[model samples]
Target: MSLEQDVATARQALEALDRACASVTKHVGETVDARRLRGDLSRVRDDLDLMAGQQSYSAYEPFAGVYGDGDDEGFGGAGRTGR
Candidate 1:
């Protein structure tokens, strides 16, 4: 129900999926489909890592600054201007 709990559940699910993929690859010998599945799994894992990291920040971290203050860039806030 909480963010931490949800993240933990997702991570467990991803780990299980990773193990299953490994087993399939071991038996199937890296076929195209197997490779695709592995790639997708890797991307999903990366996404999960990112989400977990973001969620670990304190609640105020996201809103502590407005207008792209040096302390917080706001994670893709429109206040950012490309050099």
Candidate 2:
């Protein structure tokens, strides 16, 4: 696959990661026990933020694969193949 496609996939992953972080933050605010997720959330947020930094148009190394295997049941919960 082309580097452009990899970069695009990484960008999409970064966006989804950001949305997940926001959701976690909202949940934390609504819960009384923020300490429970303090560590996990911090790590995940940092990882996502770091991953986003590698999506540059001129980035050399390819980003980690974002697409799942062809047998991924996550596509539509019906074991859909590649999209």
Candidate 3:
């Protein structure tokens, strides 16, 4: 399977897990275990989001001008990127 297909499958699984968690929380009254499960689910969602985003976005990619060729956007070029 392709990456996009894998990501879609994972997202669908996460959605199902989210609904299950909701049902469990409602039945269990949000106990410590329930909260921990929610936290773990949230972390998994975040990780999946990050991974999928990197496939189409550059948020996790390194700068093309790592050595500061006036393209660092003032990050390390001392504000000399000229906007």
Candidate 4:
């Protein structure tokens, strides 16, 4: 897919994640696993924060490389080269 498409998809995913997190939050006092849900919500929020950053959205790939650790060297290369 194109970079624009990737951005749209990521935006949609972020929105969905936000909605799910909100729903979970609404159940804070009613659910037994509220703590677990809160943790999940936090994790999702962290991911959303990452997605909103330039580095995370720089390419279209799903997994990011560890720059300092040299683990993601070849995983990225101009996300949209042709168009």
Alpha-carbon TM-score of each model against the true structure: 0.55, 0.35, 0.58, 0.35
The regions of model 1 sitting more than 4 angstroms off are 55-83
Worst 10 residues of 1 by lDDT: 55-64
| Residue 45, candidate 1: C-alpha displacement in angstroms | 1.1
Point out where model 3 deviates above 4 Å.
Answer: 55-83
Better of 2 and 3 by lDDT: 3
Tens digit of lDDT per residue, candidate 4, span 1-83? 87657767876886787678678668576565766766665565566556555443323454434354445335464353544
Q: Write the per-residue lDDT of candidate 3 for residues 1-83, one digit (tens) a residue.
A: 98779989998999998998898799889589998998888778777778776542323446555754645444555545544
Q: Kindly list the per-residue Cα lDDT of model 1 for residues 1-83, writing each as its tens digit.
A: 98778888998998998998898789889699998998788777667767777632223365445544555546665577766
Which sections of candidate 2 miss by over 4 Å? 30-83
Pairs clashing in candidate 4?
none
- Tell me how far candidate 3 lies from the true structure as C-alpha RMSD in angstroms: 8.2
Worst 10 residues of 2 by lDDT: 55-64
Shift of residue 47 alpha carbon in model 2, Å: 12
Q: Across residues 34-80, which tens digit of lDDT does each residue of candidate 2 receive?
A: 54555555555455445556433333335335444434446566646
RMSD of each: 9.4, 14.1, 8.2, 14.0
